[model samples]
Target: METTQHRVVATGHADWAGTSTQYQYIGPDQNKHAERVSWKGHAEAVRRFITDLLKQKPPALTDLSHLAAVGHRVVHGGDYTTAIQITPDVRSRIEQLRTLAPLHNPPSLETLAAAEAELPNLPHIATFDTAFHSTLPPKAYTYPIPMKWTRDWGIRRFGFHGLSHAYCSNQATNMLDRPRDELRLVICHLGHGCSAAAVQGGRCLDTTMGFTPLDGLMMATRSGSIDPGILEYVQNNHGLSAEQVGHSLNHDSGLLGVSEISGDLRQLEEAANDGHELAQLAIGIYVHRIRQAIGALTVTLGGIDALIFTAGVGENSSGIRRLICSDLECLGLELDTEANTACQPDADIATKSSRGRILVIATREDLTMVREIQAIIDLSSQGPGGVPQVTVSKSNDKLPGISNS
Candidate 1:
């Protein structure tokens, strides 16, 4: 086996199963890269993801000892993760925050531990989804909750999807060739979960999601931005327990609850096609809330120069994009009817004639993790900020720290 040196293995949970994307840049033979293996996870999805990576293509090129570091997508870093790095102390702190982000942090910690136990000698880095929004203005992050709850419990709004938002906004700027400081934009990241952000001069001015992922616009299941009084009312009158209310709000509400149907957008769309009244109601509520958030972000940014649509729903669903953008003509946003209808994923789905640019950029947080890993590697080699470029090695199909079910 040819001994390969460095590579980036980026993993993500799209359908509740982890999939690793390997990127290796060999010097002269870099152009002759191999086809990527997107392994499917069946029983133990996380374990299967790793098991398949090694089986599909053994790491013939890189040695385990030379593999520098592994970078992870660590969501909800709270106040700890401002930048990206790999250290035992950071991992411990991220584990401590599992209570804050019940859905995201704990699983990420599991993946981290798995990686660590498997490759104890190699470094593992964690890049936060909440870090970029760390630049949030106080007015945007502070909630109207009691001071004690916020100060003691860390209960202020810590926006999610900062990694995607930052990547999309920066990519938008680069593509537009505009300086980051001058561009004021509103980015809508709609997926199974949804959030809208107001970015001014590359910093988060305001966002829709507060404190928890549950805050923000209506999602596939989440009830975004609900009145706190509703929970109390449900508990007192309806005789529902706190956990039941939480479950309903987190898993039963939104499109699923409204339509009384499937949580998947495709199902909801099909129901709407069949002229189901509740489906229309569910979609209507979803789009209406999205527009509402856009309107509010307009005030936050004064006036946005560009509008960005990203994530699963934002990048893939043109109908939702059309409905959301149609009403924003007053804000100098108009989608070209033909182009909007014809656009696809990973493409710049924007209108040509619109005064304010509207773009559909695919969010690549996995690639962002690769970059962060390389940066840390460089920092280790050439002191702080000395290296011009981050070095990434190619992995020859080394297995992840996952068990096969």
Candidate 2:
């Protein structure tokens, strides 16, 4: 009774998908196209942009009757979400938690609404970034906040980047042909917004992000893992309100705040190379925080098997990777000095002589979303009594992979 299902995929980081092809479509025959598309920045706008592009190709929008399900990348699930599936109640619950992740949830909600309008009968599923880390033990997830605040208000650590971490962990396991129960892995998902996760026995035991994506490692503009005392100090000393302090932390901080110039890592890298002291300091701080997280996750996991670097900064930026892994020789982790620096995007850049494996896996959250959607569709087609088993792997051991250049 296993029926085949097709998944319609979407992402928050839609820019990561087929950008070259999309650019080609919007480039020469369409400078005018770019101007019209420019105003379409929101998630809803992408649907129209996509429709117009499809219209230009065939000059018509195609029917989506064959689509089994749509998989959406939802950024936050708070404490209530665990897996990807949708019901009226689930969608409403996601909307209710919007205040927790202002930047991410609004677009996700709009996209959800757009999809419902655009494809009325199709099932939409939400794959949350926080769901994987729901496995965190009470100690790791618990904050020192009052029990009432956490229990009633849902104020606690709910990690982000779970989808990417899950994808990388599974991909690494499959690529290495290692059994899940036998592997311990640490995945570093580095980007403009970054986070790390410790996957033991193929489950997220610990991660760097907490409550919001703003907590954890320093990010492009996010003030990750900040102290609560700072807010009290700001309120008293600077006469800043809680909302104003939040705005400053969420928007005006991180690399942009530290460098006092830019949040773009590429720009920071260039400035650092040119001996800009501020840029150097920002880079130093970023690498230092990442290293600290890695160390903590390693301790949490009791050791490491493979350390994976994915996402924008993790895949291509070898210098930063090197900086993060430097002095970890004591931990038996070595970076292939040459392979790291020469690492290419969308490729696994693992060092040859490293004691523990260092891998560069191109994070494919889109593909993960597609797979999850297909799973949900399969489960749904089985009717009320049939629930398909979710085959999640269980090993989180530290086994290295063969060098894949």
Candidate 3:
């Protein structure tokens, strides 16, 4: 008899107050089966979804006990540098970070608590989105601020979408058939939450997101990077509260704010196609920031071996990809128009003669979480030497020999 591996993923909750839960099963038959549900109320919906899934008793998973581990995608880990089995301490730490990731952490906590209540026996692991970027060097992560703020307040860049970045990097490595250590990559993860990372030898050198997800490239609603002076100026001149400024930046800006329309790219694209000026401007700004970041990260990497695009807009929007990649002949990145249009996940859309390859990869953060959880479990079983470890191959002291120009 062949064995079956089952996994369940529950995500969403912050964007629009919804939860998307998925149950997947893979057996030796090579056929994979999955069921998904999108409903309102984050924790309650996840609890009910799981309970209802169990009641149906799918052939792949007959009972809740069959689950080996329950993995969660926690957006902010604060000081947590690695994925760990969730304990009381872990839960408490996650709660404490809620203020930092006010939109994300709370729902994740609620889901974790609900899952624990419903399936108490299984191990629950938190695979932080910030964990993968913990490899950032002091020079890359440090902020040019006061010593008190940097040391005492823990104020520094803690890159987000790390799980996606790691997954994309590994997938790109496989697709390129190159050794992990030999490659230098700049990955652009564009979605509701956008970020970019400069990866060399499977390790993160630097990333765009700083301190929080709102600091990176323009996102669906978030303002991305903006002048700190603007915050004070708005407060002093416009008589806005600090909280209100934060709300406006996080909820009112980005594509929505600029276009004065929907925050969603699809909607913006539709409107832009109809010659909506602000919509067109929104698309232009979004692409401009991404292109600028790619160039900056390329300089950070010394050179770029491969440029990978993943997540919602990066994977699906060929037009956006074209606009982003245009006028980059100097960097030796030439997108194959047809290839880009017909691109699938893990597909290479670069011209055969291009020096730097361009890849469109569909990010699998859930799978990354599952792998990290399994690794931690395996490490734990090998007798207690110390805490479990998640290791990435270290790079050399000197940066790779690639020209800045």
Judged by TM-score, which candidate is best? 3
Better of 2 and 3 by TM-score: 3
Q: Please write out the lDDT profile of model 1 over residues 134-169, one tens digit for every residue.
A: 888777787787889878987788898887898888
Residues 161-222, candidate 3: write the lDDT tens digits.
89999999899899999999999999999888799999999999999999987897998889
Segments in model 1 whose C-alpha atoms lie over 4 Å from true places: 1-55, 58-61, 84-89, 345-350, 378-405
What ranges in model 2 sit over 4 Å off? 1-38, 41-46, 49-62, 345-350, 378-405
Q: Higher-lDDT candidate among 1 and 3?
A: 3
**Cα lDDT listed for each candidate:** 0.69, 0.69, 0.75
| TM-score of every candidate | 0.82, 0.83, 0.85
| Per-structure clash totals for the candidates | 8, 16, 0
Angstrom error at residue 62, model 1 = 3.8
Clashing pairs in 3: none
